[model samples]
Target: MGAECCNKDCLKPSVIGYGVVAWLSSGAALGVGIWMLVEKSTYSALLASLFYPVTIYILIAAGTFGFIFAVFGCAGAMTDSRCMLALFWITSFVVFAALGSTGFLALYYHDNVLRKDINIRQAINESETNGLKDVINMLQAEVSDKLTFCLLMLSFLS
Candidate 1:
């Protein structure tokens, strides 16, 4: 089928290019998701909600969709099927838009949280409950100082 389609000039050069990009990018995303799952799974178990299960799920979902779309895109290109290509375009657009929105919201919330006059550690320390106090202390100790510094710089620049 692919040979017939190729011989008949059914697949455009642009379609092939798009298919290649989809395959490469999807493969890369899948690799990253697996890496994150391995690297962060321990922290996820230790901190539960604070460790960001939602974020981890999103990463995995992104990779899964990427792989799915890549396969669809390649099949569409190979068989010269308009339906598959259309589905790929629509799904990929939606995925990109969702990721973009999530990223923007994360940055916005982080900046808002850090803009408060009181320091996070100070607030955590002054809280009345001992249970939360211990968790917050653990979180503070585990978090990288460089990440905080980077966020501060970003907030200041903006």
Candidate 2:
């Protein structure tokens, strides 16, 4: 079925649909990433002092890759290049897997920090030697704030 798709002059609706969806989603992802990076630019220098620059570089790379892959998807669909399509599938799977694992970790950390028994605020106040406690407190506050904001927006929509 896959091989036959390459030879057919008449492209099926499904093929066109897939190409369109891939292109649109990739573009959206790229736009959102850049927008976020730009919006946070004012605080980036301060953030760099406290955190590694690797995450900043990774976000830029991911956005660029998404834009490039969207173009590849459209071209591959138009030209019916099996190799391009295969590469797209492979990369997409890897991206999805990475995102899934990151999401799991985020949720796990969020739950741990929110547990009533964990006195995060107290830990931050008491710890002097390890700076990691401060980082943990910040992460917890950020994640909890974002989650609460999102829920409020969702509730309004519903």
The prediction achieving the highest TM-score against the true structure is 1
- Candidate 2 local lDDT, 1-158, one digit each (tens): 78777755546355556656766665665576566567455434224322123333444455556556656666776778888877766666665554455345546656554552255455557777545465655657988999999999999999
- Looking at model 1, the pairs that clash are none
Q: Candidate 1, residue 125: CA error in Å?
A: 15
**lDDT against true structure, model 2:** 0.58
Compose the digit string of candidate 1's lDDT tens values, residues 8-99.
Answer: 46656667777678667766766876776776644442333342445556656766786788788878878889899898888888767655
Off by over 4 Å in 2: 1-12, 41-60, 112-158
Taking the candidates one at a time, how many backbone clashes does each contain?
0, 0
**Cα lDDT listed for each candidate:** 0.67, 0.58
